[model samples]
Target: MLTKKSLIGLTALGALALNAVPAMAQVTAGSQEVHAYVGETFGDDLTDRRISGRTPELDDDVTYGLRYGYNFTDAWGLELSLGQTNSAVTGLPGRDIDLDLTTFDVDAVYHFNPSGRFVPYVVAGLGYASADLDRPIIGAVNGGSVRIGDDNGFTANAGVGAKYFVTDKVSLRLDARYRYLDKVVDRFDDSLNTFETTFGVGFHF
Candidate 1:
């Protein structure tokens, strides 16, 4: 026969064991999820120009946008992002140009360790970019109006990022990426390239 004290102790132990089973199940279920993030991108422009005797310069600018991703497996996922960047040009007198660049991209990401609190990933993607260039240029030979057309092109991007999970539902992220853009034609042939670094927060569901 069980004594009163022994009965109470056994009952408490059984209750504790029963509670622990759900906690373990929760941990296993938390590893696989879909997440969405919104963040701002801050970095220098890595604009490369292949024009002879001309160098490309990019102004400091910031872009803000949203990203949505879906995890297919424990370690692989795909993400799509949309954002815009504004660039200004200097060094050429009366040739200061402000460009608006909009981007849409989809990438495949491989997470290093999805079960860990801190996860790192590498990503590569193909995308399209559209740029509208606005600037004033003074004619060298004869003073005349030379309006430059809007420049649009296809772009490609690749990058790596690390995320720190604050909880099962939230994380902090940092990323660095390189983008190559198509050519732009004006009084001078110009093209834009970019190296972007972004830091932001994410939510998992």
Candidate 2:
């Protein structure tokens, strides 16, 4: 007596129920933890438009950040990070542009070995960024100021990091991550892409 649509819906519901049974059985109390890290970051700036008759140089710089995480289970967790990049522009006469980039990111991490002391994981996140540009000579020449505002973007990151457990409540961490940030700057009839590599330490509690 059931229509085809009804039959398909019932079958899908059955599959979902079967898949969720194990997840419900594996739930545990969440662990709240905080981490701080400092690392060197190399950045590449890809711009479609030329500035002052030259392409914007990719900046290799240092970056540092802090993060906090909540582990809902042995295999799954959520994390947030705040990081910054320092860079400059070249080839402009007394025209130096200092770029300060800030990012707020939230990601989900999945550990490969849930029960091992050395846990390696992969992560992906969404990020929001702000770029502050300081141009001393450009402002002096034009009697005006130029600044890049906060922009919304998506970031995809994949890295291998090992967690060495020092104690039940603490761990030592080392990570190498490569982040691809969406194009945020599209001024002067051009678009720019930003990328960063970071290494740092973290403590888990």
RMSD of each: 15.0, 16.7
Candidate 2, residue 100: Cα displacement in angstroms equals 0.7
Count steric clashes of candidate 1. Answer: 0
lDDT of 2: 0.56
- Output the lDDT of residue 104, model 1: 86
Determine the C-alpha RMSD for candidate 2 after optimal superposition of all C-alphas.
16.7
lDDT per residue for candidate 2 within 77-182, as digits (tens), equals 8889888666665444345467766778888877667566567777777777666556432311134443332234555665667654444445445677767666
- Candidate with top lDDT is 1
The collision pairs in model 1 are none
Candidate 1 lowest-lDDT run of ten:
21-30
Score candidate 1 by TM-score against the native. Answer: 0.68
lDDT of 1 by residue, 1-205 (tens): 2223433543454344334322111112224443333233333322343222334355656654567777777678878887666656543435667867688888887888777866888988988777666754333323433333455567778889987666555566778888766644344445555677765555567
For residue 36, give model 2's deviation from the true position in Å: 1.0
